[model samples]
Target: MFLAWNEIKRNKLKFSLIIGVLVMISYLLFLLSGLASGLMNMNREGIDKWQADAIVLNKDANQTVEQSLFNKEDVSNSLKKQTTLKQSGVIISNGTHEENALLFGVTDKSFLVPKMIEGKKFHKDNEVIADESLKDKGFKLGDKLSLSQSDEKLKIVGFSESAKYNASPVLFSNNNTIQKLNPSLSSDKTNAVVVKDANWQKKSLPNNLEAIKIENFIKNLPGYQAQNLTLNFMIIFLLVISATVIGIFLYVITLQKTNLFGVLKAQGFTNGYLAKVVLSQTFIIALIGTLIGLILTIITSAFLPSVVPIKFSIVTLTIYGVVLIAVSLIGSLFSILTIRKVDPLKAIG
Candidate 1:
């Protein structure tokens, strides 16, 4: 490690270039990860708040919540022995601003109710709880918003963060309010039922509804599976590319220093010591690069417009950082092998 540090200090420019490349790749990876998480949140943030284990939808709807419908009897019978919350969602335009939003009808005490960031929960028929993102749409506390298809208007009584469904901000209202807006749905009918028990799958379910795990339910959201798979592929590709880049760089650098390594071996240095130096150098470079990339990601996310969909999670970043270091170490293995194969006598001559 001491020799490794001395070598990097002596060849600052050469190592700096390698670190720069790593920083660029890591930055892109983190950014893409943030975008993927943000988009996912936009699509399912409201549902995520429920933290339910399973979602019950009509089997005939073919796994789509919007197409699934349930009658009051079905929901009542299903909830008799299990803890469940029923919710109905619809996408409609805000009558006053002409902006599209997702409206959800939820009971006040239901587990599906979002944590309020400000104001109070819905208590009256016309009162609604909205996503804080609606502030961008010019909605404020006590503002009246009419439903596009119905004469009923809702007053924004509370705001919650990250409350969205299917790329639209979510509004929480009473089931009665939703029935008023869409007369086609009866007051007892809801689009889906959220089951609270993790073992919900083992429990007997109503014949008319099927229990889908929460994770599976999220994947079934339109475009969610495809989008996530693409982003994940890109991230994996970048990781592999980064490893290749590091391996090639270190291998070439080791080749250039073959004579030096031979001389050191002749001077009684062990192969293990030389290999350690190479790995130490790789570790240092990876650490610096990951830190710089993380800092840059933080700065970039900070300056981004509020409307931009980018979410930074510490756990995700940490996992990426760990992978980067591990891959870098693996990349240096080729150089280590080269050091072990060095012929001391011939190279020194």
Candidate 2:
């Protein structure tokens, strides 16, 4: 470790340049990871807020909540206790302020509803609770929003954090209001039912209904599965590229110090000691780079435009940083092998 520190102190510029490169790459990786997590939350936060174990949908709907239809009778007859039925649909706002929004028709006291961050839950017909993201679109508590398809105006009664569905801000309304908005939908029918207990797989389901785990249900959301897979592949690809870059950098650095390594061997330094120096140097570099990257990521996330959804979790960042250091250490193994191969006589000649 002393040897590694002395070497780094002697060649500060070279090591600093490598550290800068690592910082940039790690920052990019963390940024992408944050975006991926934010997108996932946007896609499923509404469902996640439900905190339900299983979701029941019409099997004929092919695992899509919007296409599924079940009524109170179906829930009472087929679903176990602690179930909440919710109707969901995509509706456009009226006029020039037009935007697609996910409308969730939920019972006032249902566990499926998100806790209000501001104001109170819906208590009257046409009253609604919306995601905080809607605030960016000029929506506020007590504001009246008109649906494009229906003349009925909804009064925003509350706002909640992180209540989004399929990349659209979610609004919770009374089942009666949703039925009024969409006359085609039966008064008793809901898009899906959230089940809390009982093994859905073990229990017999109704003829047309299927129970899917919450994770699987989230995957079935439009573009969710594909988007996650693509982003995850990109993250993996970037990690591999980062490892290669580190490996090549360390290998080149080791090559430049070949004579020094040979002289150290001639002075009775063990191969294990030299290997330790190289790994210690790698660890120091990785730690510094990762810290810089993390700080930059946090700053960037703080200043990012609301238009760009980016979620940062400390746990996720820590995991990524650890993995990065591990990869960098693996990359340094090449230097260790080069150290082992250094011939003591080569330095004397």
Best by TM-score: 2
Give the Cα error of residue 307 in candidate 2, in Å: 3.0
lDDT of 2 by residue, 1-349 (tens): 8878899999999999889988998998899899899899889888888778898888899887777777656767655555545555556463335567878877768887777789999988898888888877767788878776777888888998867888888888888888787664566677777887656667677787888998898888889988888888988887888788888999999999889888888989999988999999999999999999999999898889887977889999999999988988998888889888889897657
TM-score of 1: 0.89
Clashing pairs in 2: none
List lDDT for all candidates, in order. 0.83, 0.82
Per-residue lDDT tens digits for candidate 1, residues 235-271, read: 9999999899999999999999999999999999999
| lDDT (Cα) of model 2 | 0.82
Query: Any runs in candidate 1 off by more than 4 Å, and if so which?
Result: 80-98, 147-152
Clashes of each: 0, 0
lDDT, candidate 1, equals 0.83
Question: Which pairs clash (backbone N, Cα, C closer than 3 Å) in model 1?
Answer: none
